[model samples]
Target: MPLALALSPFLVLGFGALLIMLAEAFGSRRGGMALGSTIVLFATGLTAAGLWMYGLENLKGLEAVAPWLLLDRFTLFFQMLLCLGSALAALTAGGYLPEHELDRGEFYALLLFATFGAMMVSASGDLLTLFLGLETMSLGAYAMTAFRKASPRATEGALKYFLLGSFAAAILLYGFALLYGATGHTDLAGISKVLRAGAVKDPMVVTSLVLILVGLVFKVSAVPFHAWTPDAYEGAPTPATTYMAVVVKAGAFAMMLRILLTAFGDAQSMSWSAGWPPVLAGIAVLTMTVANLVAGRQESVKRMLAYSSIAHAGYLLVGVVATMRAPQQAGASVLFYLLGYTVSTAGAFAALVLCGSRGRETVSYEDLAGIGRRHPAVALPLAFFALSLAGIPPTVGFFAKWFVFRAAVESGFYVLTIVAFLNSVLGAYYYIRVLVYMYMREPAVGAPVAVPMRSGYVVAAVILSAVMVIVLGVAPSDTLDVAVAAALSPG
Candidate 1:
């Protein structure tokens, strides 16, 4: 394959970001930016699919950018995932921004740029590229969090995110510096070679590993590092929150996988007796338990979903821990779970977006009271997504959890799996509560009820996401096959 073809996905997104930025500055019409962003994202996804079909490793000149960016099945998988996620977010924004009177071409531009950064994160093969991608993604996210300039909540959330994110970045960079000092290598593969050559016992190596894990855990919003999540999610525009929930999380996980597997996959670092798995398992248990417990207490629906996102990250961490013992199956499980999670989460947020208009947006459980009676079209899909998030049968969320737990079982993590299952049950309570409010409860007398917004963009996103959740849930073989293939061919 031509080098251009090998790099098509990245090129397409990069170029699209530039074009969208130019359009935002020069174009008169704001109506088309969302549509334009959607088109670019779809095109980028198709490009990744094309590369996957062509077999990324077989392509000549793929190493033209060797040690910096990798064109692999894993990268392609995340590229497609990020593109689809960003497109859905863009569609949601099309409805959400205008309804809330914050529509601007720049929002779409920032979204594209953020997505481009995420793609870079997935494709990165070197620490330099990874850090670059991380900051790029983080900057866009900070701006998006502050998009609602008139809202003090938005400003506070953005400020906290920016400050904390910068601190995390500094920690990560210091870790990288320590690694370089210890091994004299910055490339992940080179660092791995050094470790495998018997540098693993170095105290500096261990310290660096601890620092790096802290940084990555913060990015994923794991427990103790998750204080910023609910506030940011609740304060940002709905569409931006959705993007953060899916795309940003996906990118962070991608980066984590790359670093851990490539640079720290040695026996000492990977061992359950001594390595990262035990730590991650503990984090998974705490993240799931804490998030679920707190989520059930949240009065705001969006904030509840934010905690739900953290809980799902905990589930993904279970799969991550399993990778220490069953690399292929556990890794595939992680990819598949994220695929299911991306659609289910995006759908849930879209449903939330549809459940409200400008002044009457759904916030509390009471705001959703009688929504099913008022608009079954909106309520039905919301119910489906909510049930799916709860891991109900015949939904993608169920299968996703099944795969992760199966991987854990195969890896001999019985206690962790049991705890996760119990947490899943606990999580269902909050999700089901939303449905009960919508279907069973009635609004208080004279209280403002949430009204469904009318927008083809939001409806399209919701329907597509819901259908994907169902289709992938019912017949996941093809998607699973792709995930397995990607997993077997590690970056």
Candidate 2:
């Protein structure tokens, strides 16, 4: 009964997806799937909200479920966060899909399926379930990225994302095999037991750990493994890109945190070499520095944001690295940063969706000129979101950084903290440049542009982001407590 309750949202989402497929196969019109999708998204949102409240009610004593999934505080917390992020992205897609000539019922179905898979990944207690959930999410995302098949850019982007994503998946699976062979178990807890048994001096253990880290690094867009992010983000539909940037990152990070806490718990094991800490630390520095510098030089705003996403990944990794060094601060900082990241990123993407003109492909920085005068409503939100991304104070991003940096400092990683702070300064240039163009520059005469009047949902996304940015900034103790509880779970 407990396991069933824990899995309710995923089951609901899958059923909704099946309903969409059935509608597509049997309905007379192509829009049947679309109708099915809207209903499914709404229903899934309601279910997720209910599940989240229930999980909160039982956070103190949440338990593992069926050896495959864990229904503890951590999983439940992330499950809710990912669901809310996905729900907002779905709402944004609701409007953007119809406007871009890409409306299809299957799109919504796929989105729900991806969300369900992401939730599973966060809650998974074993390697097999994690891999399964990761693939389900990736497959759905691949299709959605290419939803605008008629556009050359979209098709090209989807192809690149698919190829690279498949390669990453293969690497992860191979790593899983190596791990199972070395540890004689597929479950995370079982593997941890083997690793902590003082006999993990074998080279095979090290090989498994390295392979697994390499595979996961690619998923989170760490430097030297982030080649696919910019092209995919630039090429995919904007709302889909938002989902990738926000929910996908959160899920991958959750998995990374779990692996560190459970599978690699024993520091003396062959799998826990001192080399990994420095290596990860270096990767975080390289990712933040390179991405911030490169983002400043991009002509396309979407591509710039793509680089920004990579930079944020670097920041998140700082928390992961801190966790490896000092477990306690790692938990609170990681979850807090993820929450701040999801809201700020969703708001940024929503602003982009609002900027699209009818029958025009949205791209480039120059496209936003003088929007402050023309569309104060859109411009204000975009500015706020951009400022948040730049880590401006009183915004969510600032507090997010504070949490992570404080964690890093507590862990005695002064060097990583300095690098992160400097990178944020570098990141500010491009983000502020967007605002400069939006509010300061003159609109080019005869440049075709249309700003849609605000919808309640759009206003709501902006308000939610802005309000949370402030609230979380001022009263982060409760949120931090929740994240800390989740982090200390025994699965």
Residues 1-491 of candidate 2 have per-residue lDDT tens digits of 65556566667778877877777667677644433454565565566566666654553433555458876667767766876677667667766776776767677778778978888888888999999889988898888888888889888989998999999888888888988998899889998898778535667777877888887888898898999899889888877898899888888988887776778766753122453566778889999999999999998889998999999999998988887666777777888899999988888887777776457544777778888888787778888889889998878798899999999999888988999999999999999999998889886788866555434555556676678777876787888886776674322
How high is each candidate's TM-score? 0.99, 0.92
What's model 1's overall lDDT? Answer: 0.92
lDDT string, candidate 1, 376-477, tens digits: 899999899999999987999999999999999999999999999999999999999999999999999999988899999999999989989999899988
TM-score of 1: 0.99
What residue runs in model 1 are displaced by over 4 Å at the alpha carbon? 488-491
Supply every candidate's count of residue pairs whose N, Cα or C atoms clash at under 3 angstroms: 0, 2
User: Which stretch of 10 consecutive residues in model 1 shows the poorest summed lDDT?
Assistant: 482-491
Q: List the residue pairs that clash in candidate 2.
A: 33-105, 34-105
Model 2, stretches more than 4 Å misplaced? 20-65, 269-275, 445-450, 453-457, 488-491
